[model samples]
Target chain A: MEIRTDYADGNYTIHVDYGILEASISEYIAAYSSVHFLVDQNVYALYKDSLLSFVQHPIILEGGEASKSFDAFKHITETLLERGIKRNHLIVVIGGGAAGDAGGFAAATVLRGVDYIQVPTTLLAHDSSIGGKTAINSGHGKNLIGAFHRPKAVIYDLSFLETLPHHELLSGFGEVFKHALLKDEETVRTLMDATRTKISLDMMKPFIISGIETKMHYVTTDEKESGIRKFLNLGHTLGHAIEYKYRMPHGMAVMLGLYFMMYASNEKAARNIFDLDSFRQYFELHGYPLEHLKAIDEVEMMTLMGKDKKNQSSDATGFVLMNDFGQCYFTEIDSNQLKKYISQLKESL
Target chain B: MEIRTDYADGNYTIHVDYGILEASISEYIAAYSSVHFLVDQNVYALYKDSLLSFVQHPIILEGGEASKSFDAFKHITETLLERGIKRNHLIVVIGGGAAGDAGGFAAATVLRGVDYIQVPTTLLAHDSSIGGKTAINSGHGKNLIGAFHRPKAVIYDLSFLETLPHHELLSGFGEVFKHALLKDEETVRTLMDATRTKISLDMMKPFIISGIETKMHYVTTDEKESGIRKFLNLGHTLGHAIEYKYRMPHGMAVMLGLYFMMYASNEKAARNIFDLDSFRQYFELHGYPLEHLKAIDEVEMMTLMGKDKKNQSSDATGFVLMNDFGQCYFTEIDSNQLKKYISQLKESL
Candidate 1:
């Protein structure tokens, strides 16, 4: 299936199929004089022959948290320069979130900007690919230095999902659940009813498409995340802090942050969409680290939240809070109130 | 005088007047919660009290060619992060071309993108500010990494032109001469009639406006520099190669390149508006290194030209050629033809 995102510049399509990489990519190969690949090393080793059939001499990098660093980004850009990559050339990133973020950012900044295609092999990429938010982590934070450049296209091949570990599946589901909770009652109900262990393409397709549509809905209107788009950062405030502090996977940290939000919003009578205990149980069954909420100190967590991009004022922090399903608003939470909520959530845990 | 550039995204204004920075900066300070200045150190030292009245504790950087390196870019970005600069924070860059290019690029990429104001103090900056092309030099070549991010506004206080040295005045004229040639026969006639040594604000204002208008006309329509915008690179092909090889000032190197272009184009019957010897004399009087045309090797220059962003095919390099006044076209020049042109140019010199 093909879904189109319309922007003021032009429209781009997302190609989703059970096995699209092996099927489609000839048009992309024919479009540019040079097609270079920046593949995740693990993905390169596993699917070397398949990728080689499409691209020649792919530059492989360490995937996951390792690839998102500024060092890796510099290496990729320098490699492209050494390879004589020109403006008309295309860079195709074949990997998960980290590879896409770093590679997409390099493509965005190299020669001012260049055309790049995203071939997402992991489920978490369903959220990252559509937004055109590319970045490399700084020593102080993740995605500190970045650009908002849309990819030429996103090719999501469902066949690669079979190779993902169980925890990776759960990590991917964190975003799926986020989109569902932000979407409507029907989506939340559907997500809550799904089995975490027996993951299948048939069961995941709708959720992936739904998540993309939800993201594109925010992105196409506000590509730079100036206004309503901050709603997408519903759980990312603490999620990013936790990810940076503990070196947890992005989606897992986001899952923990979501648990915090659900509890805080419920206590404040700000949102009545979900029963707190039931929702926690659903994520707990999927192996989310819900107990970490109690172990993390309130002061340290608040300090991390202060480092958020949306927190412009040095004294206060802004968060995407919900009072009802599909109704998210950016509200500035006072430091005292935020600390109080954190303490209460910790006590409950 | 105010000139506005309207694009699909938003419109930006250029404020061109004498002594407008102190008078006009208050509105900018009031508009954003944080108005941090990234001023060139020399400029800051000279006008510390004046600048302090507008902004407190501005980030100082070594201006000119020193600040255009990748290392300088990293230092400035890290400084911004260390200071807790956020998405909403405005970065006002005050300096010459290097400061504007490097700081504007940092503002463009930090937190995906941020609002930046350009306060150009040098004559060369009049060209850099309006174009929205920000870049940092790479080891491989100049401007290897950059982005097309337009400034929120360009506050050009013409009073700073008094501090410019005689060579800087000549440097600024290089771009003006190119613009005049591309604009029409009248502009060329106006330019050729002027004395090179006695450049004054009264004489330069019209040319500055003319260059900006020529630039904004192309940039407003094609912000990405993908199509007709390449016309602005009239003398830049060899200009960049010479600049990289000999370490000459950008506009001075461009003046030499323009002399070569005028001579070659006249010989090839590409254009015959101006007498070659008279044009050469005009630039030579301004301290342009016209004689160095014989010193630069044709093969080495050709190799450097191949590294240009516009060169997609390995066999040919594109140059902006003019058959008539105001009719510049990007024509592909093969290596053999380029060598012939260079030999003929040196012999004539």
Candidate 2:
């Protein structure tokens, strides 16, 4: 499948298919004067021979949240400079979200910005690789330091997904689930049905494409997160808090955050759009560690949430809440109200 | 005087006047929910009482090229975070070019970017503050790490230039001279007449405004240095090499570089546009250290020039060369030719 995106800053296409890496990458290589690779270690280990056959001396990064650090950023940029990377040269990032974030940031800031292509390996990256939001975690918070640098293109080869572990798959599925929920009730229902059975690449293909398309809808509308782009942060606000406090996988934490918000906003017309009972069953089946909510200290989580970059002020935390018919809007909730919701959410969970 | 700029990325105003700092800054402070100040140490020391009366606890930086390091960047970001800088807040940078570059970069990447205003203290900053280019030097080269982050406004208080030392004023005049050359011959002749006598604030104002206007022409045309912006690097190609090697003030090095390029490209109808003997006399009158040209090793300078980010390949270095009618265009000069020109330039000097 070929999906084209037109952002105010730049325009690029996303190509998704099984076993399409070699041919797609070769075309890019032929076009650019030179190319460098920044691959995730796991991805390198799984396909080293094939990767080496095409590109030489790839800069390998140990993929995960840990890789998204100032140290990792310094290493990649310095190594690339030592290797004599130029302004015209392209850096192809082949990995999951963390690898892409770090490598993309290096690409963005190196020589004041360079072109790059994203080759997302994990399922979660399906959501990340599309947005121009490249970042590295600062000492204070996740994605606190970054830029809105869009990629030249994204090549998603489903072949890499076959090697993903179950937890990794579940992690990626969380974003897919969020995208579906943002899309429509029918899409969410279809995704829930797909999860009920054993997950496979065949079942994931259409949903992944749809998820990217749905994300692009918001991304294209608000490239810099000034308006509609906030909607995409559906579960991310509280999700980031839980993930940081418990060191949980991003999407699983997002899943739990989504439940909390749904529980908080699940009233009147919102209840019609979001079926709480059905989502709870889905969460239970997916093994999303809901126990984190019970164990989480309300004050600590609230403190973390208060530090969220989205919040406008210390007294209130901003959230993208759903209204009737799944329509999302940004609103500020005070600390007391949020604390109340957290306690109630923990008990309910 | 107020000048407005409209670039593809953003639009902002540049206010140039004498003693406009307090009034201009107060206006911005009123508009923003909160504000933080990043002031140069020298400026703070010079105007401590006045500065303290306005912004409390301003972040003071030792103003120099050394301040444009990763360490300084980390310090500023961490300090701002600790002080509770929010998205709605603004960072007012009060310094010369170096402080603006570092502080602007911190503003650009912190929380993925915040609005900033530039309060230039030195004459040289007239050029740097207007451009959206914000950066820090890497171990490999100058400005290897940065972003194209535009400022909300630029407040160029001419009063600050009254206390500028002779060398700093000369350094700034180099850019003003370059800007004049890029403009019509009449402007260059006027600038030459202005520099022949004792320098004062009144004499510098028109040149600074015209220089900024000339720079904005190129910047607005190509916000990202992909096309016409290359012309603005007229003296910068060799200027950067000399500055890096000799630890010279930026514009002073640029003055020498401009002389070399003019000599290299001087021939036929080009002679009508450029007067080498007159320029040499101007350099001598201004106490520009032209002997550095003779002292510079050709091979070492060539290697340094080769590493310039603008170069297309190792074989040929890219330079913005002037045509017969003062029209500037980018061209690649082979290393052997560049080396030969360097020796000839040294002899001519």
Most accurate candidate by DockQ: 2
lDDT (Cα, tens digit) per residue for candidate 1, span A218-321: 99989878798899998888888888888888889999988877776776676555588887777777678988877888788888787777787777778887
| lDDT at A218, model 2 | 95
TM-scores for all candidates: the values are 0.96, 0.97
Q: Which stretches of candidate 1 lie over 4 Å from their true place?
A: A51-53, A196-202, A270-272, B49-53, B200-202
Residue A258 local lDDT, model 1 = 85
Segments in model 2 whose C-alpha atoms lie over 4 Å from true places: A267-273, B267-273
lDDT for A101 (candidate 1): 91
lDDT for B18 (candidate 2): 85
Give each candidate's fraction of reference contacts reproduced.
Answer: 0.77, 0.72
Each prediction's total of clashing residue pairs, residues at least 3 apart in sequence or on different chains, is: 0, 0
DockQ comparisons of all candidates to the true complex: 0.73, 0.75
